[model samples]
Target: MTRSVALLAVLAVALLTALSSIFIVDERQKALVLQFGRVVDVKEDPGLAFKLPLIQEVVYYDDRILSRDLDPIEVTPLDDRRLVVDAFARYRIADVNQFRQATGAAGDQSIAVAGRRLDSILRSQTREILGSVSSNDILSSDRAALMLRIRNGAIRDAEALGLEVIDVRLKRTDLPRENLDATFARMRAEREREATDERARGQEAAQRIRAQADRTVVELTSDARRDAEIIRGEADANRNAIFAEAYGADAEFFQFYRSLAAYRASLLEGNSTMVISPDSEFFNYLKSDLGTQ
Candidate 1:
């Protein structure tokens, strides 16, 4: 019985030693082997790896890209316009030794610490760079260029933290609520002023058109009156010439015709009345048989 117990104890010790000597590294993970709190090995390959049991420890970090959304921060641009900016960053751990050294911790704790540091660096850079440009630049096509600059600046500073900043992007940018209200009001006032100016211009044009029309009407009326007066004068002169020619050709006949015309004018109206002596020239036509002939 004593010999059988000794063999079982040796088998049990071997199983425990075998289990403790081996560790696994997944495809998505990178591992660091630390001996007595000092990093001794880095395992980047997947599958099984061997280490001294109870003497070495393994720390695994994700090898995939990670994303972080920073909090919204307020900034003022060169134009003195205030804005609230929200941004996000994409990064990955590029150097395990540097990451370990910078974070001074392992796994999740290290990632948490790195995140805080990254936030600080990104926030500072965002403020500095954004503050140097005009608000119009932020709101224009140059926005892409500004974001690129921020990403480059972040990558430069993140290198010391063993983080490779792949990209940094602005998620949202907007004015403060009070500023937005003021801007809207200003825009409305400007539109109103433009509308007023347009109306005044329209009125001025209408007045000009009316004045032109009035002038044209006065000119046309004056021309029509002048033409009528000239035509009347010509007709009167023609009548006078015909009368003179008739008188020159036959004075007796002309006198007889003139007396008849005068008699007709004085007696044509039913209510017309005239008083004259029988010897008057106006009565000569009425009394003479020559008028009838």
Candidate 2:
């Protein structure tokens, strides 16, 4: 009975040792087998891996790419203008051994520790590259080039920490809250001033056109009136010449016509007040029908 109990204890101990020696690694994980606090082997493959029963241990780490969203950081440009920039980074652990050494992950991989360090590197590069140019450059479409520069600059430092920086992107860039109101007001005023100047120029052009038209009208009227007066004077001179020719042609008939006109004037309808001699020359035409023509 004592031998039977001893045999059962030996079998149990062997089973426990075999169970502890075997470990399964998943497809998404890369593992490091450590012996007495030091790495003895690296198992980047999936499936069962064997290690010494009570002397070795297995540590797992994620082998996929990772991303971190960084907080907004303030930077000043060469133009002495302050701007706020928000950014994000993509990275991957390319060398697990170097990563473990750099991060001191001998026992376990702390994502927080790696992330904080990466965040610092990204912020530093962002500030350095962005500060080299003016604020206008940061706000313009040249931003893609600027972001590429920041990513390139960060690659070197991140590699020291066993991280490969895939890309660095600027999420948003903007002016501070204290400057928005002043900038907007200045822009509004400039637009209004331009509008006012345009209106004034238009009004001045219209006035000039109106004045020219008025002057042309006045000149036309003056010319027409002068021409009419000249025509009237010519007509009066022609009439006087015709009358002088007629008077010189026959003095007797002209005098006879004048005497008849004078008689008609003296003998009126409501006023006949001529007191003259009966043998006067004024009555020659009426005194005898055809006096002595």
Candidate lDDT (C-alpha), each: 0.92, 0.85
Any runs in candidate 1 off by more than 4 Å, and if so which? 1-16, 232-293
**Tens-digit lDDT string for candidate 1 (1-293):** 99999999999999999899899999898999999999999998999999999999899998899998999999999999999999999999999889999999999999999999999999998999999999988877558888888999999999999999999999989999999999999999999999999999999999999999999999999999999999999999999999899999999899888877777777886787667676776776566677643
Per-candidate clash tally: 0, 0
Query: What's the residue-level lDDT of 78 in candidate 2?
Result: 93
Tens digits of lDDT, candidate 2, 30-137:
788889878889888899999999999888887777888999999999998889899998888777777787888643346678888999998889989989999999
Please report the TM-score between candidate 2 and the true structure: 0.69
Scored by lDDT, the top model is 1
Q: Which candidate number maximizes TM-score?
A: 1
**Count: clashes, candidate 2:** 0
Task: Please report how far candidate 2 places residue 251 from its true position, in Å.
Answer: 18
